[model samples]
Each structure stands twice: as structure tokens, then as C-alpha cells.
Target chain A: MNNPADLRYATSHEWVRLEGEIATVGISDHAQEELTDVVFVELPAVGRAVDAGDPTAVVESVKAASDIYAPISGEVVEVNPEVEADPSLVNTDPYGKGWIFKLKVKDAAHVSKLMDAAAYAAQIS
Target chain B: MISEIKSSPLEAAHVVLGAKLVPFAGWNMPVQYTSIIDEHTAVRTACGIFDISHMGQFIASGPTAAAWLNGLLTNDIAKLGIGEGQYTLMLNEAGGVIDDLIAYRTGETEFFLVVNASMIDEDFAWMDARKNANVTLRNESAQWAGMAIQGPTAVEVFAKVFPDETLPPRNGIMTTAAGAVVCRTGYTGEDGFEFFSPAAEGIAWWDKFLAAGAKPCGLGARDSLRLEMGYPLNGNDLSPERTPVEAGLGFFCALEKGDFIGRETLARQKTDGPAVKLTALRYLDKGPPPRAHYPVVSADGTVLGELASGVLSPSLMTGIGMAYLPAEFSKIGTPLQIEVRGRLFSAEVVKKPFYKPAPSA
Candidate 1:
């Protein structure tokens, strides 16, 4: 599942890499693998405020659509245009170029409360 | 309330291939083996095999079988010669579809029927209660296992599996040297044959087909392949309250033949014109894949109806779907909107089939 140790994960399969006040969010590799072929990605609009567990984006495979939830409360600062143009990036490079959005964290402490990489791995396993 | 889900005879094989199993119509069936797009492409370009054991099969025989069946089903059964098959529908007294199935004339007095899985019991009960004294109906679903090998290379794969046997002509049925029944027909608009064998020998035959080069496909690919051709899924596209006339399936209803259970209503709708028609729609631009139950709207913001079946076509790389819309909006090139999660995507009513396969070499 290649879940990096530095990133924190939510039970819903999202991962966050906190860089100071701004956090980059994307689905975990394990999540992408489970989704198989990613055909379309609906990114959250920039400047939209979302609470933890709110559905902020959508990822669609051939069979069905899944909502990507906001791991923690934040205001969307940016969304990945690359993923919108080529959704397969989410399946091929979920941690890198496929990152869905950048959020200005409302509470840095809430990010710590989420599962660390080891705990996320254990939870998925 | 918990109910038992039936398992396919090839369940173990699917598990070994790491298939994603999901509950479909009261059966635990494989929805995908690899990815839906990958499997769908394989069937379109080469050969792909699908487990159809969960579907229901029946055998009708007797001196009066053909006559009896014609009175119940919409198609004229007497028109089919021995070894020939025809796609037909069984409807209720009000002309509403009960089930859509393929009827094959296996012998002078015998016919084989392949019906939808969910309607097995209801279909049987309906026919049984009205069966003539000279007709005998038998539900042989549990005794047989079925597989459909479809694609441009399907015939070649069939030859490799049964070297000595020849497949029947299109929509024809013939028995093999090993007592298996092979029907030359498929839902995917491709050259293919459906094979039915004794239940216990299912795994062996599946392996033989795979060894002969048919890629394993599941229900997910099956849905997309059929929808590409604009074929209706019984539960999704055809239903008890909708008649064949409204569904654009009047061609299969043989209204000129004689009186059938649903003939009167169909005849009336055929002459007066159905109020609503099952229409096909395609996306004008890139958007999320359309799905069933998504609301379909008009350019003027009128809520026409919801999609009966929808999918993102792998061949066309666009969203395509079907919905029952008012007659005024069912014409080809009519602009429409598909609402998904409060967002509307631009689309238009296209022709029946969203895709057409190229001529076979």
C-alpha cells in the first residue's frame, strides 16, 4: 500500500501531507488500488469551506462514483487541474501529481488526531 | 430480513482470479475480474467469457408446445424452424413486460428458453398456470450451467474448445458431442456463442474456454457491452408497468401473428403511438459517468425522467445512457440534460445504439 510515514490518513481512505498551515490532500494508494480504473475526478472548488467528513470531491470508476471526504475541517485553497483533465493520475500516482486539493487547515491539532501512517496501514490491513 | 444469496458454479474460479464479487439479483456474482474497462475492451476487440449460470433456463415440449407458447409470449414461436431462436418477450394481461428472453426451437416439439434470473419464479408461475394440457414445462436452471463467449474471435475460441462440433448459424442452437448446448447469439453486438452444460462440468468447460484464449469478464463488463448496443436490461430498462410499445420493443412483439396475453394493449399503443419512449442520450463533453436513477431534464429545466441504464462507454470515451422521455423529446439530436448530484451535464438524444461495431474481417 506504499502509505508514506509522513502523511496522515483518515478511515475513509484520504491522506493529508501537512506543510505548515497548508495541507495537500489526496486519496491513499490503497484507496486508488481498490478503485481500480479512475475515469473522472470532480475536484472541490477553491475557497469553499468544508468541515471534517464532508464530501469535498468525487472519483468515478466505470461502475460507480465515490465521494472523497474532507479528512479535516479546512478551506479549499486550490484543486489539481491535472487530475480533472486526466483522471487516471489518481490510479497511477495518487501521492504525487494526483493530489486532489490544497486546504488551509482550520485546526492543525485536528490533523494530528487523524491516524498516522502505521495506524492507517494497520487499520486497512 | 436476511435472505440467502445463491452462488455460481464458478465461484471458486472467480475467487482464484481475484474477482470482485457483488450481490446481483439475489446471487453473489463476480462484478469484475480485472477492471471493467479492460474486460469490456477485450470483448470488443478479441474474446471474453462471462458466467451466465445465474440466469434461468427452461425447456418446453409436447405436441402443443409451439402453439401454447405463442399464446403466452409476444413473438410468433411457430415461425422459428427447428434449431432456430428468436428474441421475444412475455407480457402481462395489460401489455406490461414480464420478462424478455430468447426462445430456441430445439426439436419439433421442444423449445429451450433463457430468461432473466430474478424473474425465474414469477415467469414459471405465470406460464405454468396457463399451460395447455398437451404442453409440458420444465425449469432446468439448476441442472445446467451457462457461459457466453463473445467477441470477433469468439467462433475461433469455440472451435478450439470443441474441435469436432460446429456452432449453429446466428441465433441457432445445436447440441455438442458432449451433450452441451451451444447457441450462436450474444447481447454484445459481436459474434459469439452461449454454451450450456451439465452443472457439474461447468468448471472444466470454463477452464477450456479460458485456455482457448477467452478473457474472463464479469457482470460489470456485461452491462456496459449490452448498453453500448442499446439492449435493455430487464429490471433496469424493461419493467412490469411499461409495455413493449413504450420501450421501443414492438418489433419483438409479433402483434400481427395472433392474440397473446399482452397483444391488445400493445396493438393499441402501436396504433395510437406511445406517450413516452425509451430514449438514448450521449454527453456533449467530458463529465462524470452517468448512472441509473440520475434525473434527466430538458433544456428548459423540465424534469423529464430518470435514467434506466447508464454508463461511461469505453469505446466512445463518453457518457451514454437511456431514459423514458415524453414523445416530444425522444427525437434524435434532441438536447437534454442529465442531472447528477445537483449538477446538470449537457447531453442529447442520439440514436438507439451508442456504438456500432466495425464490420468483421
Candidate 2:
């Protein structure tokens, strides 16, 4: 429920934090807690182009696997290799170390379209 | 949307203890409280209780209850003694399993049976259609809720609450302090008690169990426990399309009995040897947990079978699973490959109860 000031959220639970043209993406703490003991994380490869709302990643919990959709259309510039090596990172710190990928946002202004910290907190709480 | 699912009587209590709910048998059943591994380990090493009220129960009684039930189930009722709970399966006339259940004779003409919640409707219809003139079958599921408290220390937890030997000693049944139909039984590989009570009162019973120092566990831990013991759960491991014999559940099939709905069919299949036999597979290393329906293939890439149930065994601390493989490849030491996430992982067929049951179970 920590509404990190730098991040925006999607209704589907993905978080996006814009830094100039790049938007780092990951899931929220509320999400990891619901998923429980993440065992596997499938991250989108760097340089891959994704459209908004597309399935770009997957996080597998002990019981089930869920899709992590792309929050906004962008090109993947980098992915969190740490999560691939250790999916439990999502459980430990989904917002920081567990951030899935760095996106080269198609439009930096698109960040405005997503849920702000207060709105995302309202959505989750 | 775990919260979107309906809550059980114990939902609030479960959330208060930090349970993770998942859709199970049409209800939002808690899959775990702390972690499946931690909870699983606790039940195996100490004591744990589960809110299993979502499981369906029914009462069958009349002048000819035994005969009527014998005609419909796969087990030999003649082998049962009053107050003793027996694990058995209900099979269709085609020899396929309807559900794996427990039958307990509460009286000379009365009996209590538990069935899977998902199969309640169909099970009721099937039992009703097969009812005889001297017997009556009633679906008592909606009125009841159940709890399964299992582990080496399980008896101690219950003893504190329902003392004076209110529990059925070592797998026996007795009325308890909570007015529960306390059955000494369980699916976990441990000594345990399963309490059946009014649905409205289940949450209170759950709270008492927790207060008694029993860890609150859920369906995820339950699944791991049963799998570690190689117990076949209905619908997943055993289904209407697969006979108990093929499912490696022949132990529960009473071939000595006669005239049950699937008696002749099951008897023949038993002699013929089930075409596909259930086998336990242990991943060679600490690999990803196998999943249901993952293809099991021969070394030459021939499709041998498919995984019926699988998970990272918190008990074994390694990936474990069950599959229906050809009888020829069912040897305990056979090496196998299970395709997971579009890739193959090496595994081995091992003599199971993949986990060793504590001496108490």
C-alpha cells in the first residue's frame, strides 16, 4: 500500500514510474502479497516492442501463474535480470529491485493516462 | 479477484490471520496463511488445522442403508464396523471414479459420508437414483461445515478442547465438546481429527482450533499434503473417465464385494490390469514445480502420458508430481522427463508416498 510518489499504476496492477522517456514497470506490493511466494518470473526481453494492455510478462506463484500486462505502449529497453535469476525478488521488493523492465515509453505524456499514487492506492485499498 | 469469490463461515477469521484465498470448489478457500511450505512443515512436524467446511457431507440412513449404499459404491460395506471411518471411492457403472470419499457408520442403520464440494450435485443425483425401497439418501452438505486438524501433535490440540476421550481414539469417531461429529481421520500424512459441525458454527470451531495453538492451514497446504502421501484427489487424479484401478486406487476398491454399480466392470479391469497406472515423479534437482497436464514423454520423444497433479513439495523441498503412465514404464526407479514451460525436466519414478508419513499418521 506504499504509494511511491514516482510510480503510476494500471487497473490490472502493473506499476509504471516515468523518468524522462523511460518508464520502469513492475507490480505493486498488494499484487505480490496476493500472489504469495513468487517462484518464477517471465520478463519481456529487452528491445521488444509492446502495445498497451498486451501481455508482456508472467509471474508464477506457488499455486498459479498470472499474466502481467504492459501498462502503456513502449519498447522494452532493459529488464530486471535479478528477478529472472531470483523471482522471490518480487516478494521482497516488487517496486524497487523487482521492477520488471525499463520501457522506452512511446509518449512520455502517456504516464498521465495511468492511475496516480492516490488513485492507485484507492484502487488497491 | 480472490475476494470476488464467496466467503466461508471462517473467512473473516482467515483474513485476520493473513490467509491467502484462492478459488476452490466454487468458494474462496484459503490456500495458505503464512506460506504453504511453512504451514505444510508445521502440520508434518507439529500441529495444524484447516477450515475444510467447503467439503460436502451427507447422511444416509434407513432400514437397509448398508445394502443401498453397497449397491452404489465401490467399497464393501460388509467390511465396516460401527464408529469406524473407511476411505473409499464412488464409481460409475463404467468403473470410473465419481469421487473419493469416506464412509462412517454412526449406527446400525445410520451412516455419514463426505464428498467433494464440486461433486455434490452430481453425487446427490447419482445416489438418489440408486436408492432402494428400504433406504433414504439425504444431502446434508448445506447444513454442515468441517475442519481437518492434522499432524503428530494434532491429538494434543484436540485433547485440550474435547478432553475425556471425546475423540475417536486413533481413527475413531466421537461427539465432541463443540458438538461436532469428530472423526479421527485426515488426508495429510499425519495423525489427525476431522470435525463436522453446523455450518453456522464452523467459524467458532476454527477460532477455537487456532486458540488451541494449531496453525491455520488452507487448500494449498492440503494439496501438498495429499500429494506427498500419493493420495489421489478426485477430479484431478481420479475422474469419471478413469477407473480407480487405473488411477492406482485399487486399494480402495472392494473386489470381494458383489453387485455394486461398478462391481463387475471394476473386477474385470482389476484382473486385466489398469491400462494406465499412476506413478510418482520426483524432479532430479531443485527445479521448477511441475504442473497439471504437462506432457510426460519417453526418451525418444514419444508421448508416454500426462501429469495429473503436481507442485513444489514443501514437505520434500523439491518438485514432485503424479502422472498416469503406461504400465510398462511404471517401475519405481524409472527415469522420466516432464515437459514444463515448453521445456523438459529430468525426473525419476520413485516408490511413493513421496513423503514419509510421521509415525503417528
- Which candidate gets the maximum lDDT versus the true structure? 1
Estimated TM-score per prediction? 0.99, 0.89
**lDDT, residue A121, candidate 2:** 89
Distance from true location, Cα of B28 in model 2, Å: 4.3
Docking class of 2: acceptable
Candidate 1, superposed: residue stretches over 4 Å from native: none
lDDT of each: 0.94, 0.84
Writing each residue's lDDT as its tens digit, candidate 2 over A6-59 gives 788999999998889999999998898888788777777789999999999889
Clashes of each: 0, 0
Fnat measured on candidate 2: 0.32
Where is model 1 chain A poorest over a 10-residue stretch in terms of lDDT? A28-37
Following a full C-alpha superposition, what root-mean-square deviation does model 2 have from the true structure? 3.4
Q: For model 1, what is the alpha-carbon lDDT of residue B275?
A: 97
Mind giving the per-residue lDDT tens digits that candidate 1 earns over A13-112?
Answer: 9999999999999999999988888999999889999999999999999998999999999999999999999999999999999999999999998999
